[model samples]
Target: MSQGDERGYGDNDPGGRSDDAYSTLGGTRQTRTRMPRGTDDGEGYGRRPARNSRSLVMIVGVVVLLIAAIAFANQGGGDASGDAGEKKPDAAGAGPTAATGTKPVEGKNGTIASGFAHDQQGAQSAAANYAVALGSAEMFDKAKRDAILSATHDPAVVATLQTDMEKAYSAGFLKAVGLNEDGSTPTGLTFVSRTIPVGTKVTAEGVDSATVEVWCTGVVGMAGDGSTKPVTATWFTITEKLKWSGGDWKIESSSQAQGPTPVTGDNRASTADEIAGAVEGYGGFTYAR
Candidate 1:
């Protein structure tokens, strides 16, 4: 698929950043795990004032955007919460972004969640979980990738996706992204690629089919002891066409778009070591209602 094509963006999208692009989501945010530009004594305002200038510019820009956003929020009543006159994401139990305390599915197809309810919330949950799997570090491996496709995609799409995904994550492609032919990182480096779903919405729903859009933030690339390619995060939305097949929601097709990206914050970027430690220490969430 081409950059803005209907199907999806694969090797054609930039540097083939997404290993599982064939049946998976896309991302474009890139906050690398590296240090800021150095400020040396020999270099003052005369050295390179660009960093300082950019910082100040970003500060002003954010302040203005913040003011405008607050005003807009005030005008828009509490939304999605179904709180009569309110219109905010955090309104109440009806908040689309907030968990509704619904009983989570008790089934699992391998490590991926399965056996979702036959409703809108179920579809949303399936889409969100699938997004995480498709954007995960596990997708780098052929076997794990296949398992994910088998578990999440419609059976009709499984075979073709397996082939397309193989091409998308070819050996050369893996090497280009700082991974071995087998998709393993160098001795001391950690390869990071994980998606965190922020929210889900059912755009189109029916008796047996639903289209869900999952907003996600993902980190990818290599981080660790002497890695030049530090891990970076990207924001993207994945639109999945799902069908209630075989007693559960199965993804029929999926496409990704750049973002609903927010403004970059002033928070300092973490170092490669810190990032590696965090990824190693933290585990992913299994099921969410």
Candidate 2:
């Protein structure tokens, strides 16, 4: 979809990301047998055992030392848990991966978390977490969507975005997504809209403004017996342009693109009921950098 004309919900065209939107604006073994080397051949010439005493003694000593070494190792006094060449990856060196020690936003503008740090790391964190909120199941609800937009976005864009989202999540769009006109799932089914961030990186940064891209994998659809819209997963990246406003980072605008995707997996897909249960049972995380 063209970024220019696609507002959040309008982006949910039948072929677009929200078709699945929860009204959220879219081995082999070889064995070898060795034959005995023909009995050291006739070259031994049936000679009487004229053993080399020195070599015999050396071999005996080496065997004895090997046995002793094995015994000593088995005694468990040394650090034999790992090989000398083995190394563990350092957690800190894993790059800007996963949540660091930094705490998540403590305050909430209603259900949406707020009060992110104002630095680069903080901006990335805010954007990542906000991406989760924007793509959540809650966004299908008007009030909750408004709260999320207000909490995470630049104040300047909130009103316009609200209007855009309402138009985007039209009644037809909701019905197409297995949702009622009010954006709730039909009885006996649960609508799932979840975005799980794989990682976040700041593509650009400034003191008060930064652009962060959150790579995400999400599940969207209705889950239950006889549900036509069984939940399915997709990959996409949300690029949030944020500004330091109200003492924290807030999204000025955001857009999404299809993916920095991976090859498909071979695992069997779950049944509709199984997916619905899983969606209900699993709780989401609040992302941090």
Best by lDDT: 1
The most accurate candidate by TM-score is 1
lDDT of 2 by residue, 143-167 (tens): 7877877787777767766665666
lDDT of each: 0.58, 0.54
Cα TM-score per model: 0.69, 0.67
Give the clash count for model 1.
Answer: 7
| Residue 70 CA displacement from its true place in model 1, Å | 39
Q: Which portions of model 2 miss their true places by more than 4 Å?
A: 1-101
Candidate 1 lDDT, tens digit per residue, 154-242? 88767867766676566765675678998887899988777777766665666777767776666655668777555555566677767
For every model shown, the clashing-pair count is 7, 1
- How does residue 173 of candidate 1 score in lDDT? 58
Model 2 lDDT at residue 81: 16
The local distance difference test score of model 1 is 0.58
Q: Which consecutive 10 residues in model 1 have the weakest lDDT in total?
A: 1-10
Model 1: per-residue Cα lDDT at residue 98: 41
